[model samples]
Target: MHITSGSALYHYTRSGTSVKKLYEASWVRYCAVNRSGDKIFVTNSMSELLTLSKDGTILSIFTDRQLQSPTAVHVTETGHVLVCWKNTIIQVDIEGNKNVTSLAIPNVDNPLSMCNLGKCIIVGSSNILVLKIE
Candidate 1:
């Protein structure tokens, strides 16, 4: 599934309809699916992270001002949710949706993208930085 420009999550299929609308939320910028692909996570511009069931049901919502411009999110094997803002990385509890901790990256500017690389997080914007979460 991918986020449309109108902030809608869409899953394209080869059936007659071609595309299926999964969920609609405001300002959605990034999305991540767990390794099992059962739970999907999406982050928006309003400093909110939304967890959705595979069938498009809202499971939980996490909001915080510190989640400013949450550019990316990933779920770890150990049931941890990782989110990246402009210059900070936040670790959250997957089940409780609670903020566990936050780490700041020095000299990071407008972080617009992120990805998981096994043991590290790849944050990219003006440059690429690899961060190991311990």
Candidate 2:
């Protein structure tokens, strides 16, 4: 899957053929596909988390106040969705619930991207912060 600057997500075939447009929003910053590959977690400029189905259907939207200016999102191997909100990493469950744990980076002022490396998560900004997750 790929995202267009115009706030649209597309699914393409392995051979590089465009399958279909998956979803569109006012301003989509980052997205992560769930463990089962059936749902997508998206963070938009509105500081909201959107959960969409594979075929472009909106499933849920989380408008938690803590989602302030989310910059990146990642789906962990264990089925948790991690979102980069300011200097904290918020973990959301697969059901789109926002009442989970959040890890605050010690020195990082802002977090822009993140990747799941098995037992750890690497958050990148001006500097990199790695957190070990069990």
Candidate 3:
């Protein structure tokens, strides 16, 4: 689902010939579609994260005090939401209430992209850095 800044929600159907209207919003960005295609995760960019159903209903919104400029989001196999911004990555639980962890890449100059490769996650900016998880 794609939410336009002008307050329109657009979604493409499986048939690829049909389009559906989800809802309206003043601002929306950074959308992550779930594997099941029944739900979508959206980040307001300037604000918090929003979970919306396929039919246009808001399932939940996380308003944690520590969230700042959430620019990138990815969901893990364990159903955890990983948010990346600047030099930090925050992990949020399924309910969006519990914060699992917040990781900061030490001495990162300018991180522009990131990729997860199984046990290691690579972040790229002016230079590429890989972080290994145990």
Predicted structure with the largest TM-score when compared to the true one: 2
Candidate 3's residue-wise lDDT over 1-134, tens digit each? Answer: 35444345577655554477675556664566566766666767456777778776888887666677666666655466776677877777765556789898776643545557777777776668888875
lDDT of 2 by residue, 49-71 (tens): 88888887889988776789888
Score residue 128 of candidate 3 by CA lDDT: 80
lDDT of 2: 0.81
- For each of the candidates, the C-alpha root-mean-square deviation to the true structure, in angstroms, is 2.5, 1.5, 3.2
Q: Where is model 2 more than 4 Å wrong at Cα?
A: none
* Structure candidate 3, residue pairs in collision: none
lDDT of each: 0.75, 0.81, 0.67
Point out the worst 10-residue segment of candidate 1 by lDDT. Answer: 11-20
- With a 3 Å backbone cut-off (N, CA, C), the pairs that clash in candidate 1 are none
Q: Write the per-residue lDDT of candidate 1 for residues 11-40, one digit (tens) a residue.
A: 665453536677776776677777677788
Candidate 1: segments with Cα more than 4 A from true spot = 13-19, 77-79
Candidate ranking (TM-score, best to worst): 2, 1, 3
